[model samples]
Target chain A: MPEQNFPQGTDRRPFADGDGRGTRSDHQARPQGVTTVRRWSNWSLAALVVGVAGGTAALARTIPSHAASTTTTVVPTAGTTGAAAGTTGAAPASGTTGATTAPGASSAAPSAPKPIAVTSPSGVTTYVMPGTASGTAAGTPAGGVAGTGGTTYVARGDT
Target chain B: MTARTRTSAPALPDAWQDRGDGGPIGVAERPAIGTTARLAAWPAERLHDGAAAVDTVLDALDRQASRFRPDSELSQVQRSSGTVFLVSDGFAEVLDAALRAARWTGGLVDPTVGAALQALGYDRDFAAIDQDAPGAVPQGVPAPGWSVVALGGRLLERPAGVLLDLGATAKGLGADRAAAAAFRAAGGSGGVLVSLGGDLSVVGAPPRGGWPVAVVEDPDRADAPPSQVVRLGEGALATSSARCRTWRRGGRRLHHLVDPRTGDPAEGPWRTATVAARNCLTANAASTAVMVGGADGARWLEETGLPARLVSTDGSVHLFGGWPRSDEAPVDVSAGPSLSLAAASVGCRR
Candidate 1:
């Protein structure tokens, strides 16, 4: 694949009907009597906007929990030490789904139970440390190209 | 914390922590990505192989996305003033993730705050930065914001002043990618879990009891006690703390988790926010956003029904949705030489 580029300002779309000239001419051709009709139309539009806005407010007020609260019981294996011991009485939670904002909601987050504090397991944290690299670029590897479109999406390999 | 001078690849063998005791499950830890990376898997013998595979992906991503590295692709993009640039697939994915997070949070987690971070004295690795370094003079110019970025496939168009930073999502994304790579290379048996700092991701089949993760308020402080332990059957968990990676500026303490809207550290009563989701990326975004969202964070988590645990500035703990209760006994995740690998290899019956 070859790299492609778009000139700046391409994100803006041009007007239809020959670049706005035809649309302007059509607007000018409207009959003068239509001005009164336009006023009535504007009032009707305002009423519709208010109605929709009110309905949206009502919908926002409803709090919905789509999933039934399912709990998993965690049992501690005997002889477990440190924080792992505290896992015995803990309840497993249903995984997270994406969230959308609700209007007029309280700014502070709702509170839940306080978590038990346990020391970091000495067994895991005791591992020997390794040396760190300053940093390096992943320049095109043997299987991938640099800037050319020849690059393959390795990250999505399993997906 | 500022960037610590990158040393060299971790020493072989000795550098790999062996938490295995002839058990079916093997655990290993290595220092990488400016933090500790822990990998857990079944079949103890293959643990090192999995870690190596993950390192390949992470090392590449670090080079591409790290802002601390002058030669990184991100730094190059920042230097492309008013010009269009081409990016690697990995770099593009990082940018895409950051963009999606901003959009999902309504620009609450915007990546355009690179300049804001630099202005706050976070230009280098956390370890290299001076806590009492002279405060930065605000450029008076705000970020160009995420809207002005035009990313059409691999081609990226910058509006001259905008700076791109992947700090918000890179670690979690790396964890996800590393876990996937490790699992794929680990053969058909066992599961793989990778933790880069506090961000975690898992792939493949889990052990009979699932992986046990300790939720801690401050990840930077390895000595700080864990607040809770939860079994992750599958998916990721990420915790962001406003208390960590902080420095004193003009007698006021500041942290690295910057709020793009104000070009300043987020003002919230909560000191740390931890969230669990289907992947590390989403979990990280939600955690960071919640830290900045202040009082609104809990409501958003509740409305979304995402299980989360938060620690307030005064050291109070709060849970939302179905986050595991703190009172429950923690599951045993210890690995021994004799633990049965059959659970991962032969497949355990539910």
Candidate 2:
């Protein structure tokens, strides 16, 4: 078998955990890196001062500086709350009985995108509701086209 | 094929009349990608430029992936069966994607249905397909299967009689590509949403309240009211319906969503299944698979945790994966609103 070089920093998981950003779950195990940022900032300033005194501007450019720390915060939106409460206009039409929730869905409005199964009149189970998360599939290696970023979707049938 | 013949005038419904009305973003529409495409972008000034970028990508994909065109790269591969043929990067990517899809769905979404589609009188463009004529009986030949084809990097080798049909997957891939390109063309400072025949992708930052998309049962049904309207900050949504692209074969109604197991059109309980995935391609695949899997499809989607919305043949609606339930009354087929205006605007030049 040809060796598949799974790209670094790409989520190769079979299912999308969330918005395709990272595998980090809803709960963070550790706090944001405030001390790390301070340390890096001090080191960079010291290096710049030394380089400038030595008149080696080129050396300063080549020296590695720790990346600036960035923090991301996730906030609940009105759409989510309204949909969970079944009050949003976007929700399924009410009084249109026979809608079934997925097995994994929470009773409360779903915080993460979850799969839904809807059965038909023939009693044949036949539906999965889509979610709003993006670029969450296991990464498809870059090849064959110009643009990259986003997950791949495929469908087939038994006929 | 020439550009004129490539993109025919869009035949869209009047239901699109008030979509995105008064939204802060600018929207542009054009007849391309074998369907009407809408590009909604922030910073209204970049809307036209973003649409143009999408058009370029779609046009190139059309040339490389159009199975109907004898000169297309995919056609060349079909004709060059039994030999290793060097294909375009786009063709290779699509084929690779098809193979991956087959593996992903465990052969549920096979690309080997090309012959089956052709046998069903879908040999030409959908417009040129003879819907009234009876479809031919399939030869009972299972597609060579995805395993028979080998991809050595960019080179592809397929046995003779192994025809490939990208269909929904190609459209999904194209939508993903177009959406990403359009977003980048806007200097990545604005959000961009690309909808190709209802299979869409949203990238960058979405407008306030997110991108409002009305999901309906039959996209071709001008009289059909939207089953639901959902917002998307980013991601993709696709609807696959047995009710559309339909024809009569021996007085029996048949549609394009085929089952690879029988080499014939699929007959399922669900009239339409819409799926939302991290990307357009997966959403299209899941939606189409739901058609073949029928009741089993519901279980599979649930197990996989993919969100979806499905409408049954009896017009009973179903929702899962956080798909909201609307307060609006159920769609009354007999009393559903009609296309009040025949001349609905589909192409909006920025």
Show the lowest summed lDDT stretch of 10 residues, model 2 chain A.
Answer: A123-132
Best by TM-score: 1
CA lDDT, every model vs. true structure: 0.58, 0.56
Q: Per-residue lDDT for A1-159 in model 2, tens only?
A: 223333355324333345454444321211224445657889999998987878776656555332211111112222343433335454433322123222111232111111111111111111111110111112223222443222111122111
Kindly list the per-residue Cα lDDT of model 1 for residues A18-124, writing each as its tens digit.
44354443443443335557778889999999999998887666433222211122333322222332453223332210121111112231211222121111110
Off by over 4 Å in 2: A1-159, B1-23, B134-141, B327-350
Q: What is the TM-score of each candidate against the true structure?
A: 0.65, 0.63
CAPRI quality level assigned to candidate 2 from its DockQ score: incorrect
TM-score of chain B of each: 0.86, 0.84
DockQ of each: 0.03, 0.03
Candidate 1 runs further than 4 Å off:
A1-159, B1-15, B19-22, B134-142, B220-223, B327-350
